[model samples]
Structures are given as C-alpha cells and as structure tokens.
Target: MDIVNYTLKEYFDQKKSPCLSFNVFALDKEHEEDEQKWHRSDYFQVLLLQEGEVSQGIEHRNFDLLKHQISVVFPHQINALQMGDNAKGIVIQFDEVLFCSDLLKNELISYNNDLMHKLNHVALDEETFAKINHYGVQIFELFQSLSPIKKEQIRFYIKIMLLEIIEAAHQNYQGFRAPDELDYFARFKTLIEANFKSKRTVSYYKDQLQITSKKLNEICKNKTGQTALNIIHERILTEIKRLLIFSGKNHKEIAYELGFDSPSALNKFVYAKLKETPSELKQELSKIYKY
Candidate 1:
C-alpha cells in the first residue's frame, strides 16, 4: 500500500495557530472512516488508548494496544492504526520544534535525544494510567481554549506527560548520558540523518563535528553502546530496507540513488549486514508485511 502523508492543517480545518505547532485531541468512533489508511507525517504522535483495542503497524513491525496502553510514533514513520468500534483515546501530535526545541531546558536536552530514537509501547498500572489520562485530558481541554495561554506553557504540560510515560517504560531508554556527551551524540545523529547516504564513514562525521574520530566513537559508545561506524551502518541499513520495500526502485536505481559505486556494491553491503542479498531481503519483507 502507498503511504499517505499529512500536514497539521489536514488534521482539522481550523486556522493554524501562530504560536503553536502542536495538537491534542480525542480518538473516538467518529474517526473510524479515516482509520484504515497508512500514513506518515513529519511530526511525533503519542496515543493514549484508554479503551478498546488498536492494531498499529509502524514500518515493518506491528503493535497491538489494549486498555491502559500508550504507543508512540516517531516523525516520518509510515504507520497505520485500526481501532475497534468502541475505541477511545487521546492523541498528542507535535512537530520537532515543540519536541527538540533549543528553548528546552539544558537537562531535557539529553532526555529528548534519548526519546528520539526509542519507540515504546507501554502498559501502565492503574494508578499511573489514571494520572497520565488526567494530564492528557487537561491538555486536550487547554488546546480547545481561546485563553491567552502561551505556547511554552502548553509545551511544559506536554513535557510532564511525556516524562511520566518515559519513566513508565524506562527500560527502552538505556538511561541518560552527561549533557555534554549527549550534545555531541545528538549532533552526530542529526548529521547522519542528513548525510548517511553520501557519507558512510565515521571520520567524515568526526571531521564535520570538528572532533577526533576517537572522541566521536567514545561518545557514541557511551550513549548507545555501539561504535560510531556501527551506528552509521544501522541507519544506512534501515534506509535501504525502506527503499527496497516502498520506493519500487530496482537494485541498480537504488544503488545510484544511495551513492554506491555500482549495484553489485549495494548487494555486497546488504549481504554483509544481513546475510541476504537485496532481492532476497525485499521478498522477505514483502511476505512479512504483505505489501
């Protein structure tokens, strides 16, 4: 199935608010008609499922949500959600500005980076669920208000809600690193996201960050327990899968697009990483995802 993309404006017809690029609302039976399509957007999504069941597919994985469960969808992930007839929940969607803002407190900078990479679906104890639901309800109400509340105030509440849930699923985040180290790690991740196809070497990233390769490796290891090159390979592998399954491009076309010297080079890289050639991996993903 082709993935549909949405901007914040398409979520509703209301005029865009100048101060905020975030939204909080309920998911109820009324949304059933629009729930079948697979979609992607350049914003983060948090689903608080209070009742009924939801089957959510993100990228190549499927997650089932039950009562008292929360699920997260990161920016630009191709995903779909199918809710039960009586499904009810609250959804909070926000762009990167509200999430990875430079205005965030220095302490939250590391936490934000940690959250950026981990996609977690957590089931909470009754008390914790009630507390989180209260926060979501409050945010939804405030989002509908015409009062003069500043956007930062709304973001602060959202942070509280996210921190509570992150704690509930603490195992997914490998704990935080020192602020200084996380700054470098975060910058390295951003650089990789932008240039992983063209620059696959750790030294390239190290030079761009104006740091020694040894220091870059130390920071990546401290944060993720992986060497810098392994991290780069992981990102490249993920993109390769995305293109193979969804881009409808042949191996040679993908090779050229990803800056490989030849199609054979791309095939060799895939076999080295996954022990399968590009065509074999694509067929496997196609069977698993029924795409």
Candidate 2:
C-alpha cells in the first residue's frame, strides 16, 4: 500500500498541547490498521522499547528495535512499524515546535547526526534505560490522568526524556562541533528540507542563510562530513527514493513533480547518484522495502 502522511490533528486533541504518550499496545489499538502500514507523520516520534521487540522500517531501512534500545523518527520520515503481542514500550509523539525550543535545540542536534545515514537507533545501557523509562512512565501517566494535563509538566518530562537519549547517544558517538557551527548546519538542513524539491542548489541555500558558499560548505562538512551541495543532493535523492517506492508515479510524472526538465534528466541524476537508472533503482528499492 502507499505510504500515508499523518497530521498531528489526527492523533492529538487540538485543545491540548500537541504532545502525546502511549504504550505500544494502546497505540496499536488506537491506530490499528495504520500501525501496520507504511506511513509518515508531520510530528516527531520516539519509540522506547523497554521489553520485547518491535520490527519497523524507516525510510526503507529495516530493523528490529529490541529491549533497551530507542529509535527516533524525525518528521516526514517514511516508517512502517509492527508490534508483536508481547511488545511493551512507550511511544512519544510531539510536534516540531515543542521539540525545537531554544532550550532544547542544541541538546537535540546530536539526534540529527546520522540523518543522512539513516542511523536512528540508539543503544542504551540498563542504567540509562531505567532513567529514561522513568521519564517516559511519568509522561505516560500524565497523559492518562483524567484531570487536565499541565502542559509544562508534560513538556518538562519530555525534555528530560530526550536529554537522557541525547546523553546516551553522546556516550556512544563523537561530540559535535561548536554551537554556532551546529546552528548553521541545522538551519541549512531546515532550508533544504523545506525547498529540496524546488531548490536544489547550494548557492540558493548559501544566499538564503546569508553565508558565503565556502562557509556554508565548511559548516555542512563539519556537521555531516559532506559539502553543502552534497547534502542537498542527498535530500533530493531521498525524496526520489520515496517517490519511487511509495508514490507509484512513473518516471515522466515523477520528473515533473520534482521539477526536473524531463524524465531523461531525472534518469541521468539517478544514475549519477546510484550508478543506475531510475527503473533499476526502483526495482532495487522495491526489493529492499518489500514494496
């Protein structure tokens, strides 16, 4: 089936804060059919599997999220998740505004380190898991309360929960560069994500960020080990793969939708990136995603 795009309103009450927490089984019951379908969402999601295993695919990268492991799915990431009968965990969903607050932006940068590589799994030791699970349990309980949930209380717990995950990730990965550099890289990524389909040039982003191309390239390289143009191309390539797998649009149609001059131009771009034509890449991706 085609991937469905889920909006926050569908799962959250607009009157309350756009943040939610639920146990895996409860979430499955709430989103019964969707839980098993390939889908993407407009809000961020963090799945903490405290016990049992949850099989899922993110952007066509398949893996089993086991106990003591956490997987984060950024906004707009294609995901297909399945929970076995024994699965137990907390599923947290919150909109981007709540997550990118000034106090938490820097703390959250580490989570994006592997965005291009699609490495969203963070392995946590027992001690760290216990601490994070505590926060998760608190958030889950707050949402379950009959009384109105104090937005501040839930947000605080969510922040602490994310901080714990960030700490665990830092322990397992290298530290990032200066805050200013990281900020620039994050801004660049945001711009690219917003305009990748219409604007694919590094120069466009550099101009938008009011930075020199050289400086922008330096920032991208420092944060992702890739040049600014390379990052843009990767984003474009990602969308291409998603369209090829989920949109079911032919090459000619996909080209027009993505702003390519023609189908052959799209073919050439795909070949340049993957050393294969779009059809060949589609076949390969279909096999990988079991489309």
For residue 248, model 2's alpha carbon misses the true position, in angstroms, by 45
lDDT of each: 0.74, 0.71
Among the numbered candidates, top lDDT falls to 1
Per-residue accuracy of model 2 over 1-291 as CA lDDT, tens digit each: 576778666654554544332212234445546768877776678888888888888764788888888888876667888887777888888765455544554445545544433336777789888888888877777767524444457777887787777767766744444345446776788677668889988889888889899999887654444678877887777678768876779999999988899999999999998899999988866543441
RMSD to native for every prediction?
14.5, 14.1
- Candidate 1 residue pairs that clash: none
TM-scores for all predictions: 0.56, 0.57
Model 1 weakest lDDT span, ten residues long: 101-110
CA displacement after TM-score superposition, residue 136 of candidate 2 (Å): 0.4
Backbone collision tally, model 1: 0
Q: Taking the tens digit of each residue's C-alpha lDDT, what string does model 1 give over 1-291?
A: 556777665554455434245777799766655556887775778889998999887766787888998888876666788998767899988865355432343454445554543545677777888998888888887878634454445667788887788766664444544346437877898788679879999889998899999999998765545689988987777678768866789999999988899999999999999899999988866642331
Supply every candidate's count of residue pairs whose N, Cα or C atoms clash at under 3 angstroms.
0, 0
- In the predicted model 2, the residue pairs found to clash are none
lDDT at residue 232 of model 2 (Cα atoms): 84
